[model samples]
Target: MGRRILLTCGEPAGVGPELAVKALGCGVDFAWIGDPRHLPAGTPVAQITAPDAQVPPGHLPVIRHDFAADATPGQPNPVNAQGVIDVIARAVDLVGRGDFAAMTTAPINKQALKEGAGFAFPGHTEFLAHLAGNVAVAMMLASTNVSPACRVVPATIHIPLEQVPAALSDEVLEQAIRITHAALIRDFGVAAPRIAVAGLNPHAGEGGTMGRQEADRMRPLLDRLRAQGLDITGPLPADTMFHAPARAGWDAAVCAYHDQALIPIKTLDFAGGVNVTLGLPFVRTSPDHGTALDIAGQGRADPESTIAALRMARDMAALRA
Candidate 1:
């Protein structure tokens, strides 16, 4: 049997509704967690006419939630922020309660969500962590051979650059490694995963000329993990770590900071990157892109990233089940 995937159309003004429509059109057994009224009128929806109504092809199953305000393409209204949070909260509840197999989320605007609804947190990963009762998690961006792949987290996230050195601790690095290792084995099905760790400073600190974080902090954790028989490498130079030749040798690369990992993957496949949250009890995946309010309803939004996210969510659900 196919998994029941729950898709949360995060921000109504963005491309979420359009992507949901497109994915349903492609004939996936998924339910949309958002306002049905947000969908263009006359859109084909796969609503069960009765409790036992048979689902048909070319129709989307919508679990409706109404937005308080009307959305315009290229325009973001803070008033609808709570609506975005509500959709995600509902999907999370469904997944945690085992009502759905997995969830694929659309992009959301943090600023709009905060200003409109008083949401606190930098982005989805943090919000998910809070929603899950503050479980630790890491973000990974994935792509096929045609594009670059990367998984990243700073020893500290959402902190100012000056605070990174103080924030980089041995305990945090070890936890990140453990979470990443588990993700490779369980979620990705890698029998033995090779993980490469990037250094915090330029040229991997140039043997302390650049900085001492690698030698003082990161290297010790890598050595400990290696001693435990994990297939891991590095404190490799971040600048040289992401090219094809380097990435070909490893299953995943861990960077010291956010941009260190995200820049490469986003550069390689901006339109198709899938942001996967590692270490979650339930399967959750999202597009790497954000809600593009400027082009939301213009009908010009590309569905590639959302499509990738849906496919990934489906695969992860099957793997978990």
Candidate 2:
């Protein structure tokens, strides 16, 4: 419990700053990595030089990394994009050095990053992988202590629907599954995780009528994993896999594509959902939603997901410890 958690204030122009301030009283002891000037004028903040620095009640502890320019909520400035990226990298370094227990990120603007810094990665998941020396990683969306509580991982993410068929292969799916399986055990404290995997096509390819990927590729791989003593069930119809009864049977669901995995969690626990990175050397989590640009300064952006991410990171770290 003494180990510090770090939260990187994401895009300054978005709701990241507002949410970070709102998360101050959530009871998770964390230090912010961003410019203090970016916080709301009346927000209470205590500057810190170390990760474990303590702060008063109603005050947010901050590890300031001053941005190049003032941030205007609802209007993104590319000038500060490099600062946003720097905060993330610095937090990664600190976490890597064991200075922090876990790190939960705010939402970052990809377009602004690309325009300002020539950022090459698709998103945070990939960038973190690169920073950690190219380790295999999978994104898991989780919601706990609720009806239909579940964890989900997408085999193929951030790609066009047309490209999903070509992008997905046995290797990628296997890694996603294996990482998810191990994470359920280590991070979530599940002794015997039951994994229910979804099929790519309608009705699980309808026995090879809608698509042959399930029968030709997915089934064989799942069987191979089952034979290896993994409790896996799948190539099941995506439509039936997320209902209350079906969800009750598994600890996690590995879906064939992005939307297949995200929709259910977002639908059930939109504001409390957490995005967890599996297979990292340290725990990392983020709000399931993105930075709300329009409501940046209006105080309308809900901090529930961010709070949930922080809590989840703390719990995962505790499990690991």
Candidate 3:
């Protein structure tokens, strides 16, 4: 018996509920947090009255948070937006109190939340940071099954491409790298983690030919981290860093922006990738993809990523414990 983890069934209008139901069949030990009524009529679910409630085979253990209105598959209602937000807040509060080992969230529909609940933050990553006392958090996507299983952190996330140049700095890069390094050692159980950083420019700025960020910002930061006895590499060329031979050289790669990190992971293991939020007081993970509204109620949603998230959360929790 492992620790009971709390799971959030993200956007009801999307595939989150279906994927959650599907995840139960995958043998991950956890309880789902959402409304029982929202689950498709035929799904086997048991209401969880206690943290350690028994869940029968083929049945999902659920802690119900009744939504304002019933969710219609493939049709997001702003009326249920507040309820969606509340479920996440509940999971965070529970994890913070040690009521659960860790939390693995499903994909949320940000626009629906904003339209329905007046949600303030950009997305789950920022909202989670706000709830966790405004801590600095870095997003890392990881996969263990892929060859050269890689973990990546994007230095500048969710910012406009034009603004990336100004958004990326010595301070920002240092923060992302430091948080990632510590998380690898603590949560991932890597004794001496090797981190490779990607440059913002092509061919790692080719000695100032493509960009100066490598020479001016990243190089100095890497030097500082090296002096601190951290096994850090790069300002490497992003193009060459993700291949098998290159990936074998590092435990994780910190990239200059979002796509630089995500493209490779998604390409390698889109269905199994887990999005981990590093530097949080508690462990938090989510499916690496978003709500697939097109296939919302068709039972076509693949729960592989969610299952991977739950398994990853469990592994990370055990390491931390």
TM-score of each: 0.93, 0.98, 0.98
The TM-score of candidate 1 is 0.93
Runs with alpha carbons beyond 4 Å of true place in candidate 2: none
Per-residue lDDT for 29-110 in model 1, tens only?
6788787777766778765422223567677787777889877766778888999998898888878877778888988988
The digit string of per-residue lDDT tens for model 2 on 165-195 reads 9888999999999999999999999999899
**Runs of candidate 1 exceeding 4 Å displacement:** 48-53, 145-155
* Among all candidates shown, the one with the greatest lDDT: 2
Worst 10 residues of 3 by lDDT: 1-10
Mind sharing the TM-score for model 3?
A: 0.98
Query: What's the candidate order when arranged by decreasing lDDT?
Result: 2, 3, 1
- Ordered by TM-score, highest first, the candidates read 2, 3, 1
Q: Rate the local accuracy (lDDT) of all candidates.
A: 0.79, 0.91, 0.90
Residue 123 displacement (Å), model 1? 1.0
RMSD of each: 2.2, 1.1, 1.3
lDDT tens digits, residues 49-143, model 3? 78787778888889989998888888999999999899999999988888788999988899999998899988899999999999999999998
lDDT of 2: 0.91
